[model samples]
Target: MRLVIAKCSVDYVGRLKAHLPLAVRLLVLKADGSVLVHSDGGSYKPLNWMSPPANMRTLSPDDVDLETGVVEQWIVQSAKTDDRLIINIYEHISDSSHDLGVDPGLIKDGVEADLQRLLAAQIDLLGDGYTLIRREYFTAIGPVDILARDAKGATVAIELKRRGDIDGVEQLTRYLELLNRDPLLAPVRGIFAAQQIKPQARVLATDRGIECKTLDYDAMRGVDDSETRLF
Candidate 1:
């Protein structure tokens, strides 16, 4: 059976009124479902709430299938059958150069372009049928930093950590767990890409059977890309 995910569109103008990045809070099969999300690195403590289409009914937390994990279900059902999965677990838009700099759109475009190029260069390295999907996709599993597909159509989730943190590894682990149990996308592999990696994070990934990789990028430097090889 083919699965399809509808494009998510929140009433940005009429609602929240804040530029908080729109995120896929949670994944539920029923039309009437609630999404749960919280601030990053904050003391929010993962609060779950009900927020769905007005016409749709509210679904209990148990209504969501934990089999595939919430994030995987959301992603698989949200994208078109032929579309690839590209996730960005941590996303931020700032008018400063500390991060990707101002212009969220520009940052998004640049990152997407680089990923496309990287995939193209390693076409042979990557399994067949692999394709570049979306850019800066904010999902319930944090930001789906980057999710790819293999020749067999299995997902390869990528998590990018700008700065190393124990939470980053835990978050990615959660995503992997979700994907592993998902019947629709079982056997999905995972990749952990980061600018800097914590020692503990490294050990955690190795213990969990994930391929932890290091990605190097010159910060605020105008360079075509000094180097981006994975470790």
Candidate 2:
């Protein structure tokens, strides 16, 4: 968890005031070495992308509230247009010294990395072709933290939460609807992964045909086992 505070210039301030807020910054690692900016948190905005439109940049934040100076976090999950990489930005907690009532690991950036690690383990255990997709926007329902998939070919839309209320069944469902609507993702199935789960969310998932799993050290250890399903 590294907290990087870029020096604010007049142009930067203008962009922040116009497009986002001034919170902390965070990032989510993507499959092709690209990253996603889950939340601008007012910390930083206007990130760069190296692709065909090389030097391409995006001003993070869906919109801004000039009156309150509060810019909502941006959600750019799985922005890969092809075999290229994408980068994510968000607020991050550098360490214990910066733990302002928030668990360092819970930071969107850190959580995304953990999700990547967990997914990597699962990939090792399950197989390759499965990729990590970062999701960080709060829709009409709630926030979607990450998405996992065998998406190079098939879809396995996994929504993740590092902490907090486990009443994510509805949230997951909403996201599933979004994922399903996309012609590229219509074949996707839904999976919910978190450090913990609520009884109600579990029951709802069972009733809705959604899959839920928990991340534990054992899951990581299971990687490299010959029993793994690798392509």
Name the top TM-score candidate: 1
Task: Score residue 227 of candidate 2 by CA lDDT.
Answer: 47
What's each prediction's TM-score? 0.39, 0.38
Q: Give stretches of model 1 more than 4 Å off.
A: 1-130, 136-143, 151-153, 219-231
Q: Give a tens-digit lDDT track for model 2, residues 124-229.
A: 3334566655445344555556555663656665666664234567767778887677795676677777667777777778788888776654445454444464
Once fitted onto the true fold, the runs of candidate 2 whose alpha carbons sit more than 4 angstroms away are 1-113, 120-129, 132-144, 163-166, 217-231
At residue 209, candidate 2 shows an lDDT of 86
lDDT of each: 0.49, 0.49
Residues 99-208 of candidate 1: C-alpha lDDT, one tens digit per residue: 22344453343353464345344533344577655444455555565667767776787776566567777887888787677786668777776667888888888888
Against the correct fold, how does model 1 do in TM-score?
A: 0.39
